[model samples]
Target: YLYNGAAYLESTFAAFKQRLVPVNVNYRYTDAELVYLLDNSDAEVLVVDTAFVANVARILAELPNVKLIIEVDELGEGPNPAGATIAGLVHYGAAIAAAAPAPHIERSLEDLWFLYTGGTTGMPKGVMWPHRSLIGSGGPTFKPFGFAVPQSIDEFAALALTVHDGAHDPIRLLPAAPLMHGTSAIASWGVLNSAGSVVLLTSRSFDAAELLSTVQRRAVTNLTIVGDAFAKPMIAELEAAEERGEPYDLSSLRLVVSSGVMWSQQTKEALLARADVACADLLGSSEGVGFANSVAKRNRLAPTARFRLGPDAQVFNDAGERVVPGSGERGVLAVGGPIPIGYYKDSAKSAETFRTFEGRVWSVPGDFATVEADGTITLLGRGSVCINTAGEKVFAEEVEETLKRHPDVHDANVVGVPDEKWGNAVVAVIGLEPGVGATEGTEAELRTHCRATLAGYKIPKRIIFVDSVLRGPNGKADYRWAAAVASDDR
Candidate 1:
């Protein structure tokens, strides 16, 4: 299992450099989950951090295909480390120092890059990204920095050199999101491809203070985060710092990119007020370039959930017709650019996600959205999480975003539970801001707050305030957990 660190990057590049497949293992997984993922991915070699050695040690016997194990010590060289208990484990740094120089091996455009989905609702599936498809998909990501898509290795090398020619400083990027997810890993690859420095947070869990301090210290030019899960805390920290009259210096940051979940416009505007950075909220999934993106600056601000569709992006209704602009009809958003090959072994899912819609193969990750008259799209939640209550359809994200707009709400996840009258009643699991108590009038206050933006039916029927709303490491909502909590509530 890899954590977000230099060693993780090193192992990833080393695997690619040696033409070996590198599978990312979520450190937060249970022993069974870990075993299933490693075995399913056909992972032969394991590169794990010492911090997670105990979990690996327990599940090591189950993985027979894993012949070699390499242990990376997060702590600097010390005697009797945690990984020392694991049998037949090679030290990461020592192995590199003793190994012979790598032999020249010609790489192919067809070489596969395995990116496992977040698996919020199901088991994580590996998405196969060929070098050709992956590189082609990154054109827009690098274009903003004046870096062109290099056609050949020679051209790529030339571009890398140009970034470090003293006339132009190489871009320093810090992906606040974990590298295990595609959101951060792909962005880091783009930065490294252009000879830019990829800065990582040493802390395992996210700390907004550390992120700001690192950006100021390293002169980071670009940043990547998930959604409000990361942004909210960062905003709080920035405000706290300013209140103390020692605001963080964020002049070097030019772009703040987010993906995986809905990034509220309120958070984007807050960040822009604090620093002169453009927030690019990407509408995409692990399956695919993207469906759409909303870029917010000081003046050029787009509304929450509104995005301009990509060149090949479209929404298709159940009747297989393109959704008409200004029709107010909801449909699945599809992107038909340089997409993935397919899921590694599941042909059924592969066919379902990467489908032939209107004679064109588009990666449809089942995101529900509506087309506006001006050719922009307003995103609803994912189809998998849409709730049905009394014959009325309510997207979890749409309601969740509305609830989060309240001042006291730190985070919110909406789920549907069994209701006698409604069949499925909308229930909200909310996390309040620091020191904010959930009073008897809290539910009424939130309901009143949501009524301004949300319809009566769309408003959450029952508000459950927890210490904090749970989410995956990638900032994807834990709907399953919320559903369970709601279902258990009388």
Candidate 2:
């Protein structure tokens, strides 16, 4: 499905009901990228908004596997791309009305679920998830402390329907991230699996005010967002509202959750100050879940990138040995337990990611981290984007976070570009606060500020200020773009 959260939920659920696998398409993908993903996934039916029709039409000839097209009346302007002359073109509403009720199909634990990765390092690949593994280990199953998961589907359904007397009301959740992203999709599933209502933001773009308004209108109990990219703007909007003497009514919100990107400690504290809600930062990826998580509440805020490691998670060195806490050794984070089978149609990549460590299978998604003396895991960003400068490994995220800590910096993306002297030079591409100019003095000030918190080697070799740093719809940094910009400057 190629749309926002609202349509994504409806279409994904419908496909799930029929035991059919649904592939996620990043709506922001260009025609060629979309064609590559669609063809690679072997998609047979496409459900899309009218706005994307032209892009789809351009690639229609190449997508012979796509047998049917369902056009939703989202914009409600143009004629159906699949008109009478077009074979297998059907309106979404008409198709639903005309089709008979689907017969019950027994669902199996082996049923497939595909979530394509964001392709920051390479082309996006589908991660194959089994229904059973996804529910039990993909961070969705509502297993209370000391409670075992139900054995059967019927038991699980019964558990989902259970409502205790005087218990908190059914969770009304608002996922602010794009639904196409696994973080939002899995979160929405968790809500629906628990019989809760998911209130989706219908705006084409992220608007903090609109999201806050929806929360107020819907009496939403929970809100999900993608790290600093979403939280920073929302907090800014809240501060703006406060200045106007019209603060949003966030009393109904019980929790605010963030995943998929880095959520800074300052942002978390800012949010807690404005609303009396618990904030959770999840550290995981499409291939694994619950590697580590940090929770922030009023008067008790977790530091940025610091998380209490999950039960099934462990940090391992290059030799596959588990890294000991306080050793100060960097390693990859791996999770044991129910995890995805592999990347769909990519056995080589799958084998490299999913490996048997000490006789136990684990999913290591290439996130670099270190275990502190207290056993806390401090994330150092993904290894794929890690910069190698003079043989010293520098995590881009750590530097980016430092850059963002500056008062004038709005956002930052760091990348490693090829350098004759350093092998790969650490380059920082930053977006400053509104009305802030990209002056040499500002760059010098940022470098000096970074030096106070970061090691000399970890500091960016070159800082390029831009109006905006490239990011995906789900708030993930576009490292490719950053690298290109750095290369061009070099």
Candidate 3:
């Protein structure tokens, strides 16, 4: 109920209602928005966030389809707004709670669910998610972690619900993040699927002290986050908690899970430093793929996690063939177990990426990986941006991860650009934390540091300090966005 996206929250509630799907009139939509949602959803009743009524009134013509426009309150805290010119609108909570529960209907496990994909990628396509298919193909692969802060009071109240039940009940998660992001959505679903609470967020802003206090007050046990952007701030927050004699009673914390981004070594170490929580890194991509590994797996894989012999890892040659034993060539990471149902409205993309392998279909995300003699999957990096720099092939992620460890840097993105001498020169786009600064000298220092950890050829030849790195809602780098933004600056 605390969600920022009216459409998404409506979708979730529709599922909860089982009979009636909630139709969210867009926030930007005037009453005209009401007509659009009503027409598309075939919805008879309209629920308006009363604060949004003024906007809704602009398109009064759109209200013809609305049988009832139930106005919602300040959300979980106060009564509904008073004095609306639209005389028919009533309070939302009372209306729903007062309504008799509809009798359950027999539903096929394969019953269709309309899912709205990110419009930013292309036109918004409503993908059909079948329950059985999701359980069979995607459930096992869901290694979800959430990173959220209360964006609004409603959202915070929602977050509080995620943790609070009764004083007798055990404290649970206070998942923070936009639910539109697949990771947080999955986590929220996981929480509720287990009969847990979900706290709402407001303002989308984060306050360490407030968050820590909430965790302590609720005795929270699990927190999920994207490893890179969130880890440092969290560590600092926790440190402040300990320093002020108001240490969060974090004994309830059991797992500090991450997945949205690769957990750099420092971030992992920092996580272990604070909480004795088990960290699980699920590696996957949107192209119907999944994989999971951690420092434990990497360390045991030893010299070549990418090439080490493991049942989980494999190498494929260019001939649509799997490599022989110990071939030592990097190939795309093909994931087994659960996978996505493929992209909606794009069959060609689905066919290109998903395939049957060794008799079972595998969702092979295009990450360049290798299996060492020990069979450990050593992830070289993503395959798409494999850069041949100075006659030597370089994986930008490897170099970026190495450079990001420097105290001065928050995160780094490496790309290869045309060069007269090297064919392609390594480019480093760095984003620094607040108050952190870098100069040409700093770049030089970073170069020297990289030489110690990376081959000279892999080290970036040119470094451009970036204000911020672009990330998708899933917290994955939008290489296309970065490339575009990179050009804008130049």
Candidate 4:
């Protein structure tokens, strides 16, 4: 599967320019998952890379509403590796070159943008983002840059044109996460809307060297990554390069933005020590943005998973009461200002996720967190993965963060395993740093490390050391995979 390169960007821009809704498809989806998304989105046309043509061909019969298939030939001129072909499949370039020019048409702010997001346990859900909503949700993107929020189309265009006229500096961003994910796609769209440049990696997978070299060569001003999943590897590359006596030139990078997962303070400090870049750890989701963010520099660093809540953000208990700061009570995080319209074609989930809080509509994405005395909130992972061991609640993120603090551990994931004594035992699956091996007493050593920061009940009862902890392409934790491993080994 190709990364979100020129072809993907071209399709997105073309569709948006012509007032057509663009739905992003995950390249890692199976044939069944692909069919479900296409069918659920009510898609009329499909654009796919030649590398994935075989899978699309297999699922074609299930999608009757798909009127056209535009093939992007990523695999040079030879026959497709899978020899998969569908009748009436149009070439991407040919379709573009032979198309007649489109007539000017008035576009509305109500036009929808479908962003499909697959959470931990369900089929992908299309989050409906209208153009008007994008203005509000996207406001945060401009805020950090000291740009004024435009009130009208004329004002927006006038500001965007300044980059071309040399009146304003241009933003060149590289989204390290797959563009199919909201964290990357939203950043990409926001950059384009500001008349900035978006640099995509040619490599199909995440390559730290490629990313660093591109940053140096393209003079990337901003970068978007998904938490420690990306930060750790990039940091490893930087260290490796330094040890080789040839460090990368990261002076051009002004800012580094991460969201959708936990970006540890150690990793942030590691990057800040090497590069003069500000790291913005965002706490939000596809349903909403601007919930909270923590900006860190070398001199000024924030604690891990600690964020200053946005003006419109609030945490509410199950009883629908506003959570008190320093109360030590967990609640669902919600944001009221400038939220999505809702999920497409799923009224039940839409109603559940986006609800009326007091008088304003707020997005509650089921994240659990506690407010600290300092007025900052500490995220405690999602409620879905929270483990209740012998009536004591243990957040996987809290345990995982403590475990990763150990020098030998590169990554860690905590999951609840079936236990006869505790009902559910808190089990950890850890991946060590490169060249680090697990001995017979490695589990005990890791457990001792966890005891320093975690409560007795919260400390993992069982630790399963694996070669590496697996995460999704978007850098989100794969709790399901961890659970399976814990179950099988038990």
**For each candidate, what is the lDDT?**
0.86, 0.83, 0.58, 0.86
TM-score of each: 0.95, 0.95, 0.71, 0.96
Model 3 per-residue lDDT at 322: 79
Candidate 2 stretches with Cα past 4 Å from truth are 78-85, 138-148, 164-168
Give the C-alpha lDDT of model 1. Answer: 0.86
Candidate 2 per-residue lDDT over residues 1-490, each given as its tens digit? 5666456678887888888898988888877778888988989989987666666776788888999988777655766544544566777878878999888887777888889986576678999988877677623436531225556777655655563332436778888888888888887787676657899877788999999999999999889899989998998899999999999999999888898887888898888887899899988789988899999999787888789888899999989899999999999999988789999899999998998888988999888899999999888888787788999989888998888878798899998888899998889999998888876588789989999989999988899888898888889988888888888987
Error of 3 at 419 (Å): 6.3
Which order, best to worst by lDDT?
4, 1, 2, 3
What does each candidate score in C-alpha RMSD?
Answer: 1.9, 2.1, 8.1, 1.8
Between candidates 2 and 3, name the one with more favorable TM-score: 2
Q: Which pairs in model 4 have colliding backbones?
A: none
Q: Summarize candidate 4's per-residue lDDT along 1-490 as a digit string, tens digits.
A: 3457788888887888799999989898888889899999999988888878788788888888989888887546543555345778888888989999888888888888898888877899999988777766777666654676666878778868777898878889999998888888888888887888899887778899999999999999999998889999999899999999999999999999999877889999999998998999998798888889999998899888789898889989988888899999988899988778899999999999998879889999888888888889988877777888999888888888888878899889999998999999999999999899999998889889888877899988888888888988888888889999999998
Model 1: lDDT of residue 483: 89
lDDT of 1 by residue, 325-422 (tens): 99999998999878888999999999988988878888988889899899998888787888999999899989988888787988999998989999
Q: Please give the range of 10 consecutive residues that has the lowest summed lDDT in model 3.
A: 301-310
Candidate rank order under TM-score: 4, 1, 2, 3
Q: Candidate 1: misplaced stretches above 4 Å?
A: 77-86, 145-147
